[model samples]
Target: MSRIEWERIGRERRRVSRWSGGTTAEIAIHPATSQYAARNFAWRVSTATVEAERTDFTPLDGFSRILMVLENELTLHHEGHGTYRLRPYEQNAFEGGWRTSSEGRATDFNLIYDSRLRARMSVLEVPGEAALVAAVGSLPCEEGEHWIHRIWYTAEGSVEAADAGGNALCRLDAGDALLFAVHRSHGEESWSLRNAASGRAVVIESVVFS
Candidate 1:
């Protein structure tokens, strides 16, 4: 974990906001003071619950968004783009400027980034009593541009994390997250995590390059 900076965001640290549609909690954002509402962020990761039966999405003209349903079914109607019916953990990537609306209620995870930067989002499921090894800096990149951050959000259950040397990191419960950031030339770094509760654990992993 040398040369890397990490943060643990527990429940108390979350900035939860209520919108017309539902509530959204900001997990992490690039540049400490950047505003999501003002659309001044380079990237942002958040989880939101859509409570209204039908809700319109805010049009973000210069961004790209990746949204994943964490619970229930969600039907997204993206104007000019085909409608997408997504189940739990299923994600849809589209331009932020699309005229998008949703039908049905759901709790979702999102990664919205400036279109000029490269980003990737995915869901990882860890079975009960199982351990998973995850790595950052493994994504393919060019010489000048490289992966700089890796974020893991625990969406379900709890997970105990440890570094490559087996040093304890922290336990991430539902809505908790671990973010690691690094710079310069690095080959790869890994983290080991184990599910500490019954049933499967769902983790949303988002990787970004500056």
Candidate 2:
């Protein structure tokens, strides 16, 4: 039988920080690698609150990166691609080799994956029942030889996900996340999500294809 392993990340787990660009970043998830020289990792997710008007992103080689604005607005300047403005919930993807810089203060969510793996990230707002269902329905399951892994982060209010028969799977608060794996052998699966708090909830979904 296919099963969903659930986990809840609270504020205490986000205690680790890495300093860069005059700010500290919270490392939410970092997959283990065998050696220090190993450039590739399974995946990594993190968040940072940029208090300064301008911040330089650390150069990451041999990886693909996605950044989403969790609050406020910011403009990203890619070495070759001109400046791109991002508002709340908006995201941009770039090759890790690019020299990227940003200006304006905002809380941001980031996903970085090895170049060999395929990855995608998106932000969904669950303001009503239909929107919540649509977001949950968009999660893809493993098929054939491919495997899919997903990470869900709550950016706004609290949210809860449940299995088809109404079994509570996971509940996430602002800054919390749930990561799970799906395999081809799991067969078809269905899940639903609802805004557990009083208002709308925003979710950031990061998926990896390996």
Candidate 3:
């Protein structure tokens, strides 16, 4: 985990892996390690689908998942529970177990974190600026002992964020995500903006206390 690293998501990147019960999707593993499979909890980004008349999935022991619809609309049904609908860009949460059922189809982003770890998470919709005059000495360093992780997703227009060293860390379009981690003490850090889109940009930040 270093101060700043650029990330990009593209086709043929092999970011996806298939799951049990006949589900297909892509996955991006942060910290990209083989030990993660047996760890208490790990953050995984995935895109999954739900076909018509499909029902039941084993409850992930000590794990919870957050769903963000990326494509299509879907209606979810649970045994002894009610039905809920999610559209593109909308979000919802569901327990993974045999009780969950699905009808129709959808493609969604999943945030799977082990419940035993008690890690907290949240998603924020960042507002876009019309324009920004980026300078050479923008991103400064910070000094502290706390851990800070920042990620920006392209929801509207293009964005470029870098450190004071003039390294191009992120250049993203709509539906792209960038991850940043600061491992040591740092100073002031700044973000630069170029051509902006009308709609607001969205960012998802997760803090884990171990």
Among these predictions, the greatest TM-score belongs to 1
* TM match of model 1 to true structure: 0.94
lDDT of 3 by residue, 87-160 (tens): 87776665554276666567666666655332334545544654333332223334432443444444444565
Q: State TM-scores per candidate.
A: 0.94, 0.84, 0.64
| Better structure of 1 and 2 per lDDT | 1
Candidate 3, residue 26: Cα displacement in angstroms equals 3.5
Q: Better model by TM-score, 1 or 3?
A: 1
Ranking of models by TM-score = 1, 2, 3
**Candidate 3 runs further than 4 Å off:** 1-6, 9-11, 19-23, 35-41, 80-82, 118-158, 163-167, 183-210
Note the clash tally of each candidate. Answer: 0, 0, 14
Candidate 1: the clashing residue pairs are none
Better of 1 and 2 by TM-score: 1
Which residue pairs come into collision in candidate 2?
none
Runs in model 2 lying further than 4 Å from the true structure: 22-40, 128-131, 134-145
Error of 2 at 4 (Å): 2.8
